[model samples]
Target: MHAIVLYTSKYGSTKDYAGWIAEEIGCEVRETKKTCIEDLAPYDTIILGGGLYAEVIAGASLLVKNAAALKGKKVAIFSTGITPLSYREYYDTLVLEKNFKDGIPEGFKVFNFMGKMILDELSLPHRTAIKALKKLMSGKKNPTEMEKLLIELCDADGDFTDKDAIKPLLDYIRN
Candidate 1:
């Protein structure tokens, strides 16, 4: 099947994942800025990835807004983030709700993968936001589970990407 991997990465994790997926699946990889919905017409399978900023998947509006045009095409969307997978509520519930307000499309599937968060590499605004978030959460004497997780995540500072994490996505595409 014809396929293409398109991605929008704030740092480099999402681009790295897109590269790996393209390498394994033998498909072209392009940045979303250089691609448009019309550019995707030739591919039967489209894999779009973006790094998570707040709860939104960066550049995902392209797919969400153009869902009608992608009908009948196999679509897989992935988000790279530092949040641990054990937080099912965060990924499955909060993330899904915020990203897909109209509900996931019929042929679309979503995946989440661990990404790097080196404090030194973060943008100035991102670093400031993290510091603010950490301070806010830490101030809560009776912080909720999510708030606690947020505080913990603020200090996370390393690459957490794993090649094995793409296996499930590859399986989906192959099938």
Candidate 2:
């Protein structure tokens, strides 16, 4: 089957996953900025990847806005974030709610994977935002467990990309 993976990355984490998925499926992978929705119509499978920024999936609205044109195509979305995979409730509910407001299209699947954030490599704006977020969470008198976790995650640094993490996606694509 013909497949194409499109992705956007702020810190390279999302692009890393997109490259891995393309290697597994042996299909073409392009940055979302370089590929147009109409250009993807010929592919049978479409895999999109983006990094999570403040719980927002980057460049995802492209797919959501063009949902009608992409109907019936095999669609998969993957997100790279620092949040631990154990936060399924937050990712599955809050994150999903924020991105798929109208509803996730049928036949479309979503995946979440651990990503990296090198404090030193972050752009000034990203660093400032992270610090600001931490400060805000810390100011809460009795922060929720999730808030506490976010504060901790703000300090995390390093890359956590693993080939094993791509197995589930590969299986889904192959099936």
Off by over 4 Å in 2: none
TM-score per prediction, in order, is 0.97, 0.96
Weakest 10 consecutive residues, lDDT, candidate 1? 52-61
Candidate 2 residue lDDT tens string, 1-175: 9999999998888888898889878999998888778898898899998899878888887887788899888888888898888888889998999999988987788889888899999999999999999999999999999999999999898998776897988888789
Question: Candidate 1, residues 1-175: lDDT per residue as tens digits?
Answer: 9999999998899999999999999999999989989999999999999988888998888998899999999999999999998888999999999999999998899999999999998899999999999999999999998999999999999999998999999999999
Per TM-score, the best of the predicted structures is: 1
Whole-model lDDT values for every prediction: 0.93, 0.88
* Residue 46 error, candidate 1, Å: 0.3
Evaluate candidate 1 by giving its C-alpha RMSD to the native, one decimal. 0.8
Model 1 bad stretches (over 4 Å): none
